[model samples]
Structures are given as C-alpha cells and as structure tokens.
Target: MKPLLLEIGTEELPVGALPGLAQALFDGVVDGLVKRGVAIERDDAKPLYSPRRLAVLLPGVAAEQPEQRSEVLGPYVNIALDAEGQPTRALQGFAAKAGVDWTRLERTTDNKGERFVHRAVTPGAATAALLPEVLAEAIAGMPIPKPMRWGTRDSGFARPVHWLVLLHGEDVVEAALFGVRSDRMSRGHRFMHEGPVWIAAPGDYVDALRAAHVLVDPDERRERIVREVREAARAVGGVARVDDGNLEQVNCLVEWPDAVTCSFDEEFLAVPAEALVATMETNQKFFPVLDEGGRLTPHFIGVANIESKDPAEIRKGYERVIRPRFADARFFFEEDLKQGLASMNEGLRTVTYQAKLGSVADKVARVAALAESIAPKVGVEPALARRAAELSKADLQSRLVNEFPELQGIAGRHYAAAAGEPAEIAAAIDEAWMPRFAADAIAPSPLGRTLTIAERLDTLAGGFRAGLKPTGNKDPFALRRNALALARTLVEAGIDLDLDAALEAAGADVAEVREFILDRLRHYYAEQGVPPQQFEAVAATHPQSPADFDRRLKAIAEFALLPEAEALAAANKRIRNILRKAEGAIPQRVDAALFAEDAERELAEAVDAAIADTDTALAQRDYVAVLGRLARLRPQVDAFFDQVMVNADDPAIRGNRLALLQRLADRLGSVAAIEHLSS
Candidate 1:
C-alpha cells in the first residue's frame, strides 16, 4: 500500500464555496479510484482545505489495479455455427476481434436466448499509470457553479489554478490538471511563505504546509479561530457570541488566524441588538461580545489573517471599518420607530405577494380573518390573534428589514414592543413565522400558535388557488414547508383544530389540501423514526384532525409491538379482500339467527363485546386502550377465517358470514386500517 495525495492550489476562493468544493473533490476522487479498481477504504480518504487550496489524502491505497475478468458478447449461438456444426464466418470474425480462437469462445444462455461470448483474464496495470485520467476526471466533476477561464486557456475552474500537486509515496505522479503540470511542490500562505514548499512525500504534506504558516486542515483552522475569538472576548470582560456561520466564514477567509478585540461608540449599543449583530456578523464577519445577561456589548472580535506586531493598530482598523455600518443600523432603527408599526403596514398595500395572489395587504386581511376564526379553537382571544396577524407583514416595509431580509419577523417584534402593544401581541407578531426553518422552535404562546396556523393556511390556500402547488423541486410558494409547519403546530403543539375545516374556511379544496398535509405528515413521522406503514395505517382513514391522526399513529406504533399484531393485521387484510369481492354491499347489522357456524357465532359475540367495552375509551380518545381491547378479539377473528368460508353455496349463509366479517373489519378499522401494517 502507498499513501496518495492531490492538491489544487488556486487564487482565494469564496468563503461560501470552500466547504462544498472540498466535499465534492473528496467524493469525486474517491469515486474515481473505486471505479478504476484501485482499493482504498472510504474512511482513509481525508479532505484538507484552506482558503487557497483543496487537498485529498489517502492513507492506504493500492499500488496497482486488481486483475480483472473480461467478457464480450458475440452473435447468437445458432447463427455463429453452420448446419454441420462448424464455425461460420461470423464466429471467425468475432473470435479474431476478441483475440481468441473460434473454439475457445463459449456459449451462454440468457433471457434473450443463447449467445456466443468471449471471456478472458487480463493482468492489471500500475496505479501510477491511471493517475492522470483519474485526477482529470475528479477535477472535471467539481461543483463549480460558475467556472472561470484564466489567460487564453480553454480550461475553466472555480478559481484560476496556480499549482498542482499529485504524489504517490515519494514519486510524483506525471499528469497535468487545469492546464498546470502536477508536481510535489505546493504553495503556502501568500504573505507568510516566500515561495513554493516542496513536499518530500505524500505523508509529509500537512507538516510541510504547517511549517510554512498555513493550517491546511479546515477543522483545525475553525477550532483555532473559535478559541482565539473567545480569548479575545474574555480580555474585554465579556463572552464572545461566535455564531457557527461567522466562525465558518472566518475559517475560510484566513489561512493563518489571529483574533483582535475592537469596540465601537457606546451610543451605537442603543441600536436593536439583532440589527447590530447582523451587521457585525454578515457585513464584517466579526464575532460580537455579549454580557453575562446575554446582552450585546460594544466590544466585538475580528479575525485577522496575520498576527500583527502592533495589535493596537489592527484593533483600530477593525473598529474604524464597522462604525459606518453601525451608524446606518442606528439611523434605520430610529427612523422605523418614527413611522410606527401601524404606519409601516400601510406601505404593504403596494407590495405584491404574488402575481395572481394579490398584494401583501390582501394576504394580511385574509390571514387576519382566518386568525380570528381559529383563535377560539386554540384557546386564544380572537381579537389578539387578529391584531398579531395584521401586523406580522409590516416589518417587510421597515428599513432594517429591507437591509437584512432575515430579520423580517425579528424587526416586527422589536417595532411592536416599541409601540407599546401588549406583550402577547408583540411576541405573536414574530412567532407567527415560527419554525422559520426545519430546526427552529415552534410558537410558544397560544396566541402565537393560532396566528401561525392562520397565516400558513392563508398562504397555502392562496398558492394552491393560484395553481402554484409544489412539483419536483419548484416550490415557488414553499407549500411543503408550509404544510409541515401547519401540521407540526397542530400535532406537536397539541392544537385540536380540524385541518380539513380550516382549509375549507380558507377557501381551499378541503380534500386536496388534507391529503397534502397528510403527505407532509408521512415524511415528518418517518424522519422521527416511525415507519411509513404506521403513518399510512392512520392516514388510510383520512382523519380530518391532525391531533386525532397523531393519537391514532401513537396507538398503532405501540400496538405494532404486540405479539398478536401480525396476525391481527393479516386478518384485517384478509377481511378487506373478502369484502371487496362480495356480490353487494354488506349489511351494517349482523343477525344472530344467520350465524350457523360456531366460529362465526363466537366472532360476532366478541365483536359486540369489544365495541361495547371500547365505547368510553374511544370517546375519551384513549386510542391505546381501544386498540388493546380490540387485540383481545384476534383469537376469535383468526378462528373465523380459519373455519368459515364466506363464499358458501347457500346464499343466506354466505351473506351472513360476509356481514359478520364486515362488522369485525369495521370495528378494527375504526381506529386505523391495520391492513396497511401487513407484510
């Protein structure tokens, strides 16, 4: 085994593009090696990247490709031979092309009938001989959204390539990538290293780069940045708020990192903390410092590419660059306050939400009406819910929100509070967009939850009514996310609103929208480790209430663990198949006089007793108890299917047996269609 290394040195890459490029390079190289029959463990391939380079190191790679068996198909066997059973002209030509004697060719039979084939074992080639093609393939497959050409060269890449390194053990792999000749030399930090750093062997790459003042490994660079930022913040008597995004961007912006503490004017601290943090993190890529109470301090930490001799100068430069952005934020905040949230809402009338869905103000009106209707259902005051919904989109017209679109809801919360609105209303304005992303928290207040559901419903209704449902990856309206958020709020938050009725109230097709919501639930529960079949069982009944659907699913999951679950599920399936084939509709009422067989009589009795015992449990929505009670009838159910035949020659007997099975199936399916659980 030999260690393998490949590095592509380039001009500074976009910070946002570094991580994805590294992963894509690693995957492409690993796939290339595997496809060429070069043995290498997946875990043995390591990705190392900094702002100026992307590298993949393989610790244990085969020195040569494995010997392989080759086969080539020829003409059909019958056509390959003459009437006398001697080789024909076609067989002779095929054997010659395959470099084998006609007699050595074998006959094989497949779905398409007999065919003549050539088979042989061939020796493998050295891994070094295949490196040029493999390396080219890996580079050609990089995920460069926009490839650039440098000089007059035809080759295009994410960035202009300056150097290439391809080494196998102590030997340099002869190849040219991105119009640059592959060699053992790699460039380091442009300022720290004077020239190219020579790597003696594949294993010496990391140490050689480190000695040149470059942390080639992104993970190590990120850790260093984080530790330095925290220490810098500690020096100023505050804790550093190093968001993951800022840390990652900083990691990609520098090959050598040094965190410097800087501060702005104390008056700038009066700006909304979110606006300040956004400006610092987004525009400047700086980590803000916070007091013990989680309030933003004037001090912020900026990551520098070099360790300056006069650190005070670097600090001053950092503070100098951020002052204008802070002033802009402060001005935007004060100006927005003067307009007030209600006044800002007036500007929404001219903003279009969608071409066919009317203006933003129209959406607000619809959402407000829906919120008023759903408020009482979720135990919130109708007036409060309507007020929150009305002002939720007002932030879109704010200067801060226009500058930082991600702060839409956050800005509304701040503005509403400044206007002296009720705390619930202020919080609800922001919470209405709760679960802005998959991992975000749902609304905490009842009023917030109510408004969230109402807003999402209006969006869904308007989008679908405009014929803009999501198809493939083109969800311009984000219907999938809207549906999942609605379902999560209803089921996880314990809201008992009828999803179907809510859709109807919003002027959406109730049946179609209900299916859409349930489809999202199917995926939502599967992600939580629930089986698709478990969700389908409850979904088969098409429950209108998401809460009821959730309860039934919980019962089904627990019931599935019972030893009798398989037999019960299988029996339910059998009953359904029988009912489908019946001559006519099965009578709802089962007559005892028609129960001639003992198994049928016993099943009827068990059905009656189970239904009688489960009435209170079902009414209370005690699904677990209801399912457990139904499990007791599995023995009688099994016996009826085993001994009684539904298609008996006697018309009365067949009808009675069909009705009996129908009653049993209805009782079992009242909670869930257990038949879906069958294997």
Candidate 2:
C-alpha cells in the first residue's frame, strides 16, 4: 500500500468560497473511496485548504477491493414454471435480468406463501479499477455553494481548474474534473513560484506545496500571519494592533502572509474614532493603530500577499485610499450635527417603516404608547418609558446613521445627549436595540427594557400584520430577530407581562403573532443550550408569555431531580385519565364528606396540601419547593389508585373521587401537563 495525493489548482478563488470547496472535495473523495470498498487509513488522509487550491492526501490506500457475494431476487416460482413442470419465459427473463443462467436459479418460499427464484454469485473488480468512475461521479455532483463559469467551458464551479494532481500509490489515476484532466502534477503559488510540481505520493503532498511557497495548513498560515504582524508592529516605535476580525479575513485571503506597517495623518483622528476605524477596517481591510494607553492612534497595519522591498511604499498606498473615505465621514458627521437631534427626529416622519404599516414616525408613536401601557407592569415610570420610546428611533434620520447604517442606535444615544436630553432618555435610545444577537446582553434598566420590548413588539406586530413572516431563511423584515429580542427581554426582566395582551395593546392586527413568538422562544431556548424535549415541555405548559415558558422550564428542571418526581408524574397521568373519563364538566371542589373510603379521604387531604404548597412555591417562583410538595403526595396517590375504585358503583362516591383526581390534574397542569411528557 502507498499514499495517494490530489490537488485541484485554480485561479485565485474568493476567500468566502474556500471553506465549502475544501470540505466538499475532501468529503466527496472519502465517500467515493468508501463506496468503492477502498479502506483508507484514518491517519493517512489529510486535507489542506488554501484560497487558490484544494488538496487531499490519502496515505496507505488499499490497491484493490475485497471480493463479495450478493443475492438477487427473481420471479416467483409459480410464474417461472408452467403447469407441465417445465421452465417458462418468465424464468429466462428473470435469469437474464439477474445476469445469470436459468440453471443457476434457486427457489425459496417467501412470507406470502409464494415460492420465489433467486440467484447468488460473487462480484469481481479491483478497488483501484473502480476509483476513477466513482470519483468522477462524486466530483461532478459536488455541492458548491456558489459556482462560476470561467474560460470557454459553460460548466460552473467555484473556480476554473487549471491543473489536477491525481496519484494513487505512485501510479497516475487518469481522471477528469470539470473538463480539466488529472495526473500526478500540481501547481504552486501563482505569484512566487512558476512550475509544474510533481507529487511523488500522498506523503509528499504537504512538503511539495511548502517547497513551492505555499503553506498548506490553514492554522499554520494564520499563526504565521499573527506572529509576523506582532513582530512588525514591535519593530516600529508606534505600537500596531491588528483587529481580530480583519485578521480572520486576512487568514483566508492568502496562503503566505507578510505583515507591513502603515501610517496616516494624525488629523484623521479629528473625525470620530468610529469613522476612522471603519474607514480602515471596512474599506482597506487594515488594522487600526493604538497608543500605549489603548486609545486608537492614526497608524494601521495591513497584511499583504507579498513582502515589498520598501514597506513605506505600501504605507503610502494605504494612506492614499483611506484618506478620502475618512474625509467623507467627517463631512457627514458635521453636516448631521448641524441639523441637530430635534430636526433629525422631525425628519423621521418622512421615513417609511413599512408602506402598509405606516411611517417610522407612526412606529415611534405606537412604541411610545405601548411602552406607557407596559410601564406599570414592568415597574418603570410611565413617563420615562414614553420618553425613551420617543428618542429611540430619532437617530434613524441622523446623517451619521445614514452614512453608517450599522450605527443607528449608537448615533441616537450620542445625538440625544448632545441635545441635552435627559440621561435616561439618551441611554434608552441606545438600549432599545439592547440585544442585537441571541446571547447579547439585554437592557439592564427597567425603563430601557420597557422601551426595548415596546419598540420590538410594535415592529413585530406591524410586520406580521402585513404578512411579512420569515420562512426558510428569508426574514427580510428581521421579524425573527425582533421576536427573539422580545422573548429575551421578557425573560431577563423577570416580568410576567402577558404577551397576547401586550400585542393587543400594541395594536394586534396579526392573529399568528403568539405562534410566531412561540417558535422564536424555541429558537431562544435552543440558543441557551436547552434540550428540545425540555423546551417543548415548558412551552406546552406556558404558551402565553415567554417569561412563563422560562418559569415552566425552571419547574421542569427542579421536578426532574425529586426522588419520586417520575412516579408523581405517573400518578398525575392516572388522575388525568380518571378526570378525562368524567367528561367535560370538571369539578372545582372536592367533597370530602362524600368520600366513602379511607383511601379517598387520604387522597383528598394529600391533594389539598400539595395544591397549597404548589401555589405558594409558584407565587415565590420556587419551583423546587413545588416539586418537593408534589413528590410527597405521590405515595398517597398511588395508594388511592391501588385500594379505591375511582368509578365506584355509587355515583356520589365516584364523583367525589373524580373531583379529588381533578384537583391533582389542575395542580400538575399548572407546571406542565404530564400527558405531554414523553419517556
């Protein structure tokens, strides 16, 4: 056994397309090898991904597939044989289809009492002999996320393939991929090396690429970039800092990285710090400068594909590109402040949030009203919630936000404070978008949470009313994000604000909003790392408020630990069975006097005590306490079921026992219905 090496050389591929291509190439090869009965030594196969190439090395690949036998089902014996005990045309056809002779066919009785004919034989083929065809089919079917057409070929792929190296144990495995013929030769770096590098075997794959000026390992390339940048920055008296985000992009941009220091005018700092950094990061893909005190400096660091003779030349090139971008940002900032926050707030009226829903100004009014209505429930002053809502979207009309749309909320905070708005109002303006992502921190202040929830609810309700629901990753209005934000705020604030009522207060025009929120709550729990079953259990009990769903989860968590919690659940299930049999009329109160047996009385007392404890524990949100009390009643419940007949011949006794079980069902349903629990 020897190693096999392959590399698909192409023109410079986009950084984004590299990961998917590498994964598909590696996976497709492995799947093809497995399907062909070629056992690949796990340690022998390695994949390396670079922007310009995707390579796979297979060590110690088997030369041939093991022989195997297969059984083939044929026509029924009755059909294969005529009434005169002679072979019919069906037997000949079946034998031909099975690729065997009629004499080789055997008969067996099937499950339906019908005799069937079958054939058994060994298959012949070398694994290496089958490789080219299967490998070709797999590569042809590779799922590229985004493909392109290059050269004269209409075939679309991630990149145009220039060379393909396919070596199987020092032997050339002739194959073709996307019109490119494969052999034993691969290419090196497009700029630094110019040659057809011959791969001796799979073991030589990495070393061969390294010699040709390509660092084959992605992690190693990233490490080299980080190490070189740090050294280059330290060489300069002014320290350099590479943004982690830009470092990630640069990692995918080049196989071999050479870091260079760049500097710009200190006057660029006069532009807002954010604008300067954005100009460097967004446009130039450069790291911003930082002083000893960690304040952003005027210098930046750029990672280049080639090491230039004069580093200063690269610095000049970067400065030339970034200067004009910063100048525009500075102009926008000054022009925006000229109109001031109040004028920007007034301009918001002209901006449409949704054509059918109304303008952004109308959204602001709805948010303010919703916030005011929720203020009492959230324990925030009504006036403060309204004030925060009014200022929340004022920055949407700001020139700064218009220029950098990502800074919508941040600009509002800055502009509000500049206009001498109250500190709470200014903070709320920023906090309204409190959780941009699922794990992002929620609003900490009461007033901020209220305003955030109100704004998000208004957006969600309005968009839902317009039937702009997200489906299959098509959330144009980001209604999913808005719902997630609402769920998190409700849970984090620990407020039991009824979402259905809140939706009504927020002008509920969509009947499916509750279902939408429930779906988002499941997403939210999934983000929190909760198991799907536990999330469903909680949602089954509390479908109204996201906060209640969270509380139900807490109850389930505590209940899961009680010694008899499972048995208690079983008892609750049995009680629900008895109550369900009692028909639709549920008895509100248990009649202890009507209890004809000691078991019934004991069960009634146990249920009443459990209900009281469960109610207290629920009031204090002490789910553990509720579970403990419920656990204590489990034995008594079991005893009642074992000793007493729930549906006695006497109607009064049966009704009393049924009412006792109904009480048990109510208490358990308050947490989570046992019927919904799965084993």
Best by lDDT: 1
Model 2 Cα lDDT, one tens digit per residue, 1-679: 6676778888787775676667677878888878877777758355687888887776667777666666666777777789997779988887788777787777777785555466454564666577678666656766776778876777677778888888887788777877878887877777788877778876787888888878887778888988887776666655666676677678778876788787777776766676677767766788776777777876678887766678678778877888888888888877877888878878888988888988888989999999999999899889888888887888788777777876767778777777888887888887888896656899878888988889888888888788898889899999888988888899977888888889887776635888888888877778778767667766666556677778778777767767776777667767766776685465567776787778878878887777876787777767657766777887787888789988788876777677777777777767666444535
lDDT of 1 at 463: 84
Q: What is the clash count of model 2?
A: 1
Tell me the TM-score of each prediction against the true structure. 0.96, 0.92
lDDT, candidate 1, 1-679, per-residue tens: 8889999999999789999999889888889989989998556456899989999998878888889889899999789888999988999999999987998888899998899988988888888899888877887888898999889988799999989999988899998876789999999778878989999998899999989989998888898999999998999999999888888889999999999889999899888898999989999999999999999999999999987889999998999899999899889999999999988999999999999988999999999999999999999889888888999899999999998898888899999999999999989888888889998888999988988899899988888899998999999989999999999999988787888788999999887887898889888898999998888899888776898899999999999999889999999998899899899767767888987789989988899899999989988989999999999998898888788888999887888888888888888998899999999
- In model 1, residue pairs whose N, Cα or C atoms come closer than 3 Å (at least 3 residues apart or on different chains), thus clashing, are none
| Candidate 1 structure, TM-score to reference | 0.96
| Candidate 2 ranges with C-alpha deviation above 4 Å | 43-47, 114-124, 143-146, 230-245, 289-294, 509-511, 584-586
Once model 2 is optimally superposed onto the true structure by TM-score, how far is the C-alpha of residue 518 displaced, in angstroms?
Answer: 0.9
Write down the worst ten-residue block by lDDT for model 2.
Answer: 112-121
